[model samples]
Target: MSRILIVDDEPHLRLLYETELRRAGFETMTASNAVQGLEFVETMEPDLVILDIRMAGMDGIEAMQHIMERDQRVPVILNTAFSSYKDNYLTWAADAYLTKSSDVTELVETVKQVLEKQATAHG
Candidate 1:
């Protein structure tokens, strides 16, 4: 099973993503802020990271940079409430970019697709 690190400031989102991803058969871990997420990236070495664009401190863009610096191979999915960040060049660094929604089906599908694509590339 692939391990996914979910980084978001919202508690509900963390729980929701964790629950749904677990149901989908992926192992999951969550960080409430970018700083902790970066730490987890280094220590836990998750196969993929689902990062939020905006947080109280150290936004996802900056955190993604740090994560890439540590290990470029790990895939990152930028999950944000704001669609405007999609136009930003920094977000392009992520393997996938998804806008938040009430329904999480898209998010789950994207995670599966990204991980599958990564497996193909590395395998």
Candidate 2:
């Protein structure tokens, strides 16, 4: 089973994403901030990460830089409410950038695709 880490400040959004991803057959873990997210990445080493940009402290882009420094192999999906960050050069490091939505269909699909692609590349 592929384990995915969800990094977001919003508890409800985390739960929603966790539930949706779990239903899609991916194991999910969540962190409320970038610090926790990076710690989980170091300790748990999830297959992929769904990161939110506009958090309380140490935004997703900054956390992503740290995560990449630790393990570039772990793919990151930037899950932000703002589309403006898509133009930000820092977001380029993310494997994919997804704008948050009430419907998580696209998010789930992106997760599957990224995990599958990364698996194929590694194998």
Candidate 3:
């Protein structure tokens, strides 16, 4: 099973994502902030990372930079409430950028697509 790390400041959002992704058959990990998320990247080495752009401290853009520096192969999805970050070059480091929504259909589809692409490339 593919492991995905979800980094978001909102506890409810994290829980929602975790429940949905798990139901989709993904092994999920949760981190409340970028710092913890990065640590998970180093230790857990998740297949993909779902990140929120706006957080308490190190934002998703910054986290993407650090994550890429560590392992460019790991695909990151910049899941944010704001779409303006899409214009920022820093966010380009991520494989995908998604606007947050209460409905997680898009999020689930994107995760499947990215993970499939990764598997194909590495296969």
The 0-to-1 C-alpha lDDT of every candidate, in the order given, reads 0.93, 0.93, 0.92
TM-score of each: 0.96, 0.96, 0.96
Backbone N/Cα/C clashes per model: 0, 0, 0
Candidate 3 Cα lDDT to native: 0.92
State residue 105's C-alpha deviation in candidate 2, in Å.
Answer: 0.6
Candidate 2: list runs displaced more than 4 Å.
none
Per-residue lDDT tens digits of candidate 1, residues 21-81?
9998999999999999988988998999999999999999999988888745799999999
- Model 2, 93-114: lDDT tens per residue? 8999999999999999999999
Q: After superposition, how far is residue 23 of candidate 1 from its true place, in Å?
A: 0.6
- Candidate 3 lDDT score at position 99: 93
Instruction: Report each candidate's C-alpha RMSD, comma-separated, in the order given.
Output: 0.9, 0.9, 1.0
TM-score of 2: 0.96
- Candidate 3's displacement at residue 123, Å, is 2.0
